[model samples]
Target: MKKKKFLLIVLSLLVLFAGFTLTKSFLVSSKQPAPVPTSVVINEEKAIQNFSKALTYKTISFQEREKFDLKEFDKFIAFLKDSYPNVHEKLDLEMVNDYGLVFKWIGSQSNKKPIGLTSHYDVVPVLSGTESNWENDPFSGAIKDGFIWGRGTLDDKIGVIGILEAAEYLLTEGFTPSRDIYFMFGFDEEIGGDLGAKAIAEKLKQRGIQFDFVLDEGGAIVENMVPGVEQPVGVVGISEKGSATATLSIIGSGGHSSQPKDRTNIGRIASAISKLEETQFDGKLRGPGNDLFEFVAPEMNFGMKYVFANKLLFKPIIEQILLKEPATAALIRTTIAPTIFQAGEQYNALPEEASAIINLRLMPGDSLEDVKEFIVNTIDDGEITVTVTGTEASSISSTEGPQFEAIQQAARNVYNDSIIAPYLMFAGSDAKHYDSISDNTYRFLPVQISSDDLNRMHGTNEHISIKNYINAIKFYIEIMKVTNQQ
Candidate 1:
């Protein structure tokens, strides 16, 4: 009788587990994007040629303001005028802060709020020694092996040229938009956009101009990064991680080489840093992280779907999986990178002061104050002083809104079969500055790039495929057509 009772209980538990698993496998999908065909014809050869020429200008954004080449910027502007005569003749162009280019394509409906498309023309300075590593000269803008090889090819001159190409084509087709469209090209985005986008946003804000939505570069069509989604997934950044720098420092006696106290300043600082690194902030899969899985789970295989679909019940398990990989891990929590460590000049002498700078990419839920608290608490050392400074994460944009849908629809139109989902941007971009003036600011370049190509964005051998460039132009044209129709 006792054995029978135990067997009955076990059977009941197994049945309950089976029921839960069965229900979890069938996941609910987030959004079903209807097919929208684009008939816009891209002058492929000319588009590639213009991008190649734009790359040769070397509109490099240097940290020091004096290093900016105004002559090159002027030449790029002239090139834009020479290439897109219709855009120059039709749109009212205004130069903000001398070099920041703003073009307004006035629409028939003046009352409708304007949509701003922004991208930076400037590229990061290539490391001195690494320039030789490029197959073609970094500044040559050589079109070789089906790629426009150069610095600005991917980091964003494509955006500037792509937008113009689309607008120019639309003008040639005699298509007048129902809503006003603005193109803002920033020159100083590589450093911080202080004098470029910041100035543009401020000038527009002061003039009482508000944007319906703004699009800038952030996420791209990533392959193999998102698990279970076989087709390339286009990630549109609805919000970005906050960038913060925390300097942990300690000042103590500069001791002699012969004898010293048990714990020197350098040693103490090192220990604190070790503790902070080892005791990293607990990774939590909520906000954008959770939302990302929510969007992708339905498209996942049966097993993966079963795990993510039951997110509420198995959140800990999901977070554990995401935390295992560095790239996926960044999507969930704040990242800590110890960049600079300074202690001693000579080998023998114990330095008086020691400091280390930890750069942190903060999650939307984590604030600057919250990050400081975590570091202080983690280090748990009274001697070490921690100072944190950076801008907070921008407000989360709604994925359910028309603004995001327009972006998703545009990418879907170009890359017909790719899965379009919204995720938080891990890097900083000029889009963050426009948050105040626009109802929603989205970051998507609409170009399909591989993981290797992603690494080359701010690194050496940066290039964009001729196919991707033309597709980007088509995507921009599709975006204009999809949105603003009465």
Candidate 2:
């Protein structure tokens, strides 16, 4: 009897385990088929060679506007014309702001709004002491260990080359777009893009040229980007946080060291900063965070899927867990960080005035007025004055419609197994300049890179794998074909 009871218990456990496995498999297989590309073939070596050669030019953006070397910019353009002869001959090219280049490929029909693709050519300056950190000369155009090394490999230049390669290849194959396609390249994106993308946007707006969508550089494929997910992740920026600078200042009477009041200028400023830190912007999972889970939920394991699939019940708990990490916490709320501070001269004397500069990244619904009010209420010190200067957050673009689906389809076509999802970009990009004329604007970089490679983007030893560069080119071609089909 004892032996029979043990056997029955073991059999029951086995049945339950099998049922769980079957149910999990069913959920995973329920996902819809991803859009597959008609064809994908690109010469990886040739693309790498072209990218390496493009990196030879030093088109750096300096804080002082006069320090810009137009000669190098001219060289970069000349190189493009020489390398992509078919593109130069087939498409109409125009120069704005002397350095910004716009290429228009006319389509069979003119009724539909045009699609715009943009990237910047200029790069940030290489600091003097960081040169030694590079494995090879930063501008040597060196191909080492299956990667093309340089300064602009992962920044905006890859977007420029990848787009041109697709256009040139399509032109060779006698493919013409059904709707107008505009390839806009900016030169001074690193220095705020005032002279490049912003100028181009204003010019296009004046001519009543509106775009169905605008795609620019912002996010890329990252490994372990999310906490629990093991697959490679791709983030598409549907909205970007607003950047603003706030100055807090306090003034008091200067006096000798021995005779001090309870509240000095420095003390007041310090106390205000402490209060602001204690009372940070509200961090709750909303907006882009919610959108991101919708796309990835179907691909997750049962435990993760259950939480995401039934988010209404688990949202508060999930958000509370996310709030524990600072980086993830920023996704749901505005952030405040004191960037610069100024105060007294000598230890013996009290300072008359003290000031601090705070950098704030505003969320979608938050306004400049809301930020000011929050600061005032939190500190509650009338003697301390505050002032703010910057643009409000850009409007959020739609994740629905053929526009977003097209982007997702194109990404899946190139990156076969990866999950493509939408998230809010924490940093600023040139896409903001097009918000006025574009109903949907997305920022995505089509390349598989590790977190280390991501760090190298604006840092030394910046490079891209030969395979990734070819994939990027193929992605652009696939996007063009998909857009035309729609």
Candidate 3:
């Protein structure tokens, strides 16, 4: 009788523990509030009109950059002043690097560090004959069938106009932030931002002003961006891959084609190139990949959820599957592609020297020295020489911090149905310039875009939906609220 009583007591304790665990899980999941309040209304027509008018200016960044008619940039600035009178009156604006514009909105309090929101005004030069691909003139800023078409519609002008609209609206509504806000607009981001964002970052550094968080243009919303996710995914870039160029050269004895030695200059260089391609850098899921899964895992289907939920157990298999697709492959590993090859000048004579240039995108944990060593060890050719030069990848920002969560929550408020996940940006951006002075740098373009829209960004037929322009403005407003709440 006593033994039966002890068994009943043990079973009761086990049941109680199970109930507690389930209740805890439920509470944790339910604690997060609904992403956005439905009460806030957006003026879609006005936002689209402003975005369309902003795109009409021909502020293309040229590589050689012949004296750009500063008059046009000046006109663009004046147009902003006229269009957003509230923003102009409320925010203190300063011009950096001749054309770069920075606006500071002093907050109700100044104890916390400021947050920066940045975008570039300049667009890439259109190729001479590619204008035919455009549905309308690239600079016309045509609004037709609920779309605003033009260059800079998607690249970055959307961000510039969107933030201004939010600020204008907030100022008119008598909303003030707890922390200071800065809107930084760079003029030459398309041409590497040397005279624009870089100069501004340097100036800020001199002033000893460090930002709590800096948000810039990088990734966007697109369908099928990830292989398995059905919803249109919005990727926020926490870090960007560094770009480097590696040069391989081999010098050998010149001889007649018929009497060429077994290992000539061309053969040695070609062999080295082949070796490098065959032996790529190691592939593993880490950094931004982990952050991406954390955000999307809750919304994933059963099968994807299982894989993502137990990532430590399924990492190798997940990586193998991701490697099969080129687009997905890039996310998990560094990439290498040969861009230039130079060899023989004549048809019959063997060239004295041959060289090849390889472009590499460095992952977060990898460095230029690591790349050089990998090339030398893999090729193992004594006569062939390899040289590498470029910037190493930037440091990864924390995903757990309040800054990241604030950005994610703001994105969710603007894009309620879409998932906001952090990932590494394959392309470089102006945000990289501010990494030295900021604790958290995030890259996100607050616009819903299709995959084809990405091609049109620096290409032909660049455009954005009227709905997306309004959403971009809404996102900025939500970000302001989220940032201040923390």
lDDT of 3 by residue, 1-486 (tens): 999999999999999965764443333321123577424576767777788888889888888878576778988999999999988888898889779998999988877899999999998888999888778999999999988889888888988998899898888788999999989999999888989999999988998879999999988877776655677788889999999999999887887898888888988888888888888887888888767876776666656765666677679998898777766677888888899999998888999999999999988988899999999999998788899998878778877788877877787787776667889998889999999989989999988788888888888888888888888888899899889888
How do the residues 77-174 of candidate 1 rate in per-residue lDDT, one tens digit apiece? 89999999999999999898888999999988979888999999999998988977998988888998888899888889989999999999999999
**What's the best-to-worst order under lDDT?**
1, 2, 3
The global Cα lDDT (0 to 1) of model 2 is 0.87
TM-score of 2: 0.93
For lDDT, candidate 2 versus 3, the one ahead is: 2
Q: What stretches of model 1 exceed 4 Å from their correct place? A: 2-10
Per-model TM-score versus the true fold: 0.97, 0.93, 0.91
Deviation of model 1 at 290, angstroms: 1.4
**Model 2: CA > 4 A from native:** 1-38
Local error of candidate 1 at 288, Å?
1.4
User: Which stretch of 10 consecutive residues in model 3 shows the poorest summed lDDT?
Assistant: 24-33
Could you tally the backbone clashes for each prediction? Answer: 0, 0, 0
Model 3 scores a C-alpha lDDT of 0.84
Number of clashes found in candidate 1 = 0
lDDT accuracy of residue 140 in candidate 2? 79
Q: Candidate 1: give the clashing pairs.
A: none
Worst 10 residues of 1 by lDDT: 23-32
